[model samples]
Target: MWSGDELDLDAYLERIGLRENPLAPGELRADLATLYAVHRAHTAAITFESLDVLLGRPVALDVKSIEGKLVHGRRGGYCYEQNSLLAAALERIGFEVTGRGARNRTRGDSLLAVTHAVLVVTVDGEEWLCDAGFGHQGPREPVPLGRPGADVEQGKWTYRIREEEDGVLALCLLRGDTWRDLYAFSPQRYHPVDYVVLNHYSSGHPHSSFVGRVIVQRPGDDVRRALVGRELTSLHPDGRIERRLVGPDEILTVLDREFGLRLPDREAEELVGMYLAGD
Candidate 1:
C-alpha cells in the first residue's frame, strides 16, 4: 500500500503550483475534475529524469524521501519516484488509487519486462489511468479506462486506450496519422513492494536504460522534449521531431533552461564529469 498518511499534502499541493489548498472547506472534491487538475498540474510542474542513478545514488521510494528530493529539493526523478509520489498524494486526497506494473512496449518487437509503474484511480465506479511518470510522450491527463477506441484529447495531443489479448490494455498516442503504443499493462494489481523490486533493476542494473545515461524529459502540452545522453529531442504534435547533440559545456545550462532542473554545485560537477567520462 502507498504510505499516504506520511505525506505532507499541503507542501505537495504547493509544489505543483496549487498555492491554495484544494482540500480547504468547499474548495475541492475528490472527483474526476480534481483528479484531472492534479494530474495535469503534477506532470506540467515536475520533470522526468534519472539523475541519481547516474550519480550512483539509490532512488528512494518513501514518501518523505520523495518529497525531500522532488518537492522541496527542486529535482526531477524517473517513473518509480514520480508515480510513487503521485500515488501517495492522490491517496491522501481520498481517491481510490491502485498501483500497477506496465511493460515498455515502445522498445520494439521483443517483450520487455514489467518495469514501469502506473496508477489507476476509481471515482464514481469509473476507473481512469492516471500516470504522471511516463516522460514527454506521456499523457498529461487521465485516460478513461474500459473505454477502448475512445479518444481523449488533452491539449493538442490525443490518446486512447486499446484493448489487447488476455485483458491487457495498451495506452496509445496519436502521432501524425498513426496510433503508437506507449505501454501496456495487465489487470494484475501491484503493490509498493513490487515497485521496489522493479526500481532496483531500473536504477541499478547494467542493462537498464537509466544506468550510465542522462535521461530527462518534460511533457509539455504543445511540444514534448527529452534529453537522452547527449542527444536532445523535441517532439511536436504533428510528428515532427527535432534532435540535437548537447555538448558537455552546455549540459547543465540545457538542463536548467530546458528542463527546469538545477542541481547543486557538487552534483553539477559530478554529472558533468560523468558526461565527460562517457559513463
Candidate 2:
C-alpha cells in the first residue's frame, strides 16, 4: 500500500547502491529482469546484522527507521524490516507484489509457525521471488518460480529453485552435487503483525543466535563472516574455505576496517572485554 508520495525512487535506488533507477513494471520501457539483476548486485554488497541491538541502540520496527537503517544507510537489515520496506517500494513502482510467509527449511518441518517474510512479484505474466533480507547476500534477482532449474545470484551464493509437493517451492544451494536447504517459502500474503511477532523472537529471544552472539556477514566474490568466539570463515566462489583466528581486539579493528561498522568507544571496549573474558 505505497503511494507516490511515499515512494521515493531516487532514495530507494541509492539505498540499494544503484547509480540510477532501473525500469520497473509500468514505468518507461520497464524491464523487470534488469531491475532484478541490479537489486541482487546491490544487496550482495551489504550485510544484515543486529549490531545496533547488541550495541544498545535498538531500532523501532517502523517504516521510517526501517527505511533509514536498511535503505538509506545501505546496511543489512532483518526480514520484517527489509522485506516490508522493499515491498512498499515495489508497490509504488507499479509491480503486483505480495508478502509471503517463509520458514527456515534448514531448521526443520514446520509450516504453521512461519518465521520469515519474502516477496513474490508478478510482472509481464511471470512470477519472480524477491528476497532482500535473507542475509548479507541472498538472491537479489527475481527467481522464476515456474522453471525446473533456476539459479539466482546472491553475492557468491548460487540459489537453485526446484519444485516440491503441495505447490510449495524448495530453495537450495548447489554445492558439489548437493543442494543445501536455506529456507522454503510460499506465496501466502502475511499481515504486518505476523512479521512483528517473528521479528520480536528473532531479535529478543534468549536462545536465538542474534541475541547470544555478534555476527557480521558480507557476501563478496568471496563471502566472509565473523562469528563471536569462533574462527572467521571465508567462502570462496571455487568452494575453498579460508579460516582465520580472531582475537578480541582484532574484532574491533575488523569491525571498523573491514565492515565499515563503528562502535561507541565504551561499547567497543566492552565487546572486546567480553570476548576476552569468555563471558
Candidate 3:
C-alpha cells in the first residue's frame, strides 16, 4: 500500500494548485477527468530534480516524508519521490493505483537498469499510464494503456505508448519527426518497497547519473528546460535545443528564476561550493 491515509490530502492538493480551482466538480472523484486534471497540474507544479541525491542525502519514499519535502517544503524530487507522492494522492482519492519499474531508454542502445518509478491508474475499467515524474520530456497527462501506439497530445507535445515484445510497453515522445523512446516498462507490478531499493541505488551508487551532478527539469507547454551540471538546455517542441553554461556564481539564481526552485540558504551555499570546486 502507498500509505494514502497518512498523507495530508488538502496540503498535497493545494501544493499542486488544484484545491482552489473553481472548475473542480465539487470534490475530487475517482474518474478519468479528475485523473487527467490531477496529472496535468502535478507535472506542471512540481519539477523533476535530483538535488538531494547530488547532495548525498537519502531519498525517502514514504508518503509522509515525500509530502513534507515536496508539498510542505516546496522542493522538487526525482521519479521515486515524485511518483510515490502522486500515487498516494491518487489512492487517497479512491482510484486504483499501482507501481511499475521502468528502464531509461534515452541513452541510445545501452541496456540500463530499471530505476525509474511510474504509476498505473485504473478508472472505470480503463487503465491509464499516469506518470508525473519523467522529467522535461514526459507526458503532461495520462497516456492511455488500452490503446497503445495512438498519439496523445498534451499541449504542443505528442506522446505514444508502443507495445513491444514480451508484454512490455515503451513510452515514446515525438521529437520533430522521430518518435524517440523515453522509457520502457513490463507488466510486473512493483510496490513501494521495490522503489526503496531502486531509490537506494540511484541516490548513492557511484554509477548513478544523479549521484555526482546537478540535474533539474521542468516540462512546459512551449519550451522544456533542464539544468544539468553547469549547462542549461532549453528544448523546443520542434527539435530545437539552446544550450548555455551556468556559472557557479549564478547557479542558485538560475535555479530560482528558471526552475522555480529556491533552496534553503545553507543548501544553496553548499551547492554553489560544489559547482565552484567543479564537482
Reference-based lDDT, each prediction: 0.90, 0.64, 0.91
Candidates arranged by lDDT, highest first: 3, 1, 2
lDDT of 1 at 1: 69
lDDT of 1: 0.90
TM-scores of all candidate predictions against the true structure: 0.97, 0.81, 0.98
The residue ranges of model 2 lying beyond 4 angstroms of the native Cα positions read 2-8, 20-30, 107-113, 151-157, 224-229, 263-270, 277-279
How would you encode candidate 1's per-residue C-alpha lDDT over 1-279 as one tens digit per residue? Answer: 689899988788888887564645245567988888889889988999999998898999988999999999989888889999999988888899998899988877888999999999999999999999999999999999979999999889999999989999999999888889999999999999999999999999999999988899999988999999899999999999999999878999999999999998999999888777773
Best by TM-score: 3
**Residue-level error in angstroms, candidate 1, position 150:** 0.9
CA displacement after TM-score superposition, residue 187 of candidate 1 (Å): 0.5
Candidate 1, residue 194: the lDDT equals: 91
Q: What TM-score does prediction 2 earn?
A: 0.81
Worst 10 residues of 3 by lDDT: 19-28
Per-prediction RMSD in angstroms? 1.5, 3.6, 1.2
Task: Write one digit per residue (lDDT tens) for candidate 3, span 178-242.
Answer: 89999999999999999999988999999999989999999989999999988899999989999
Model 1: colliding residue pairs: none
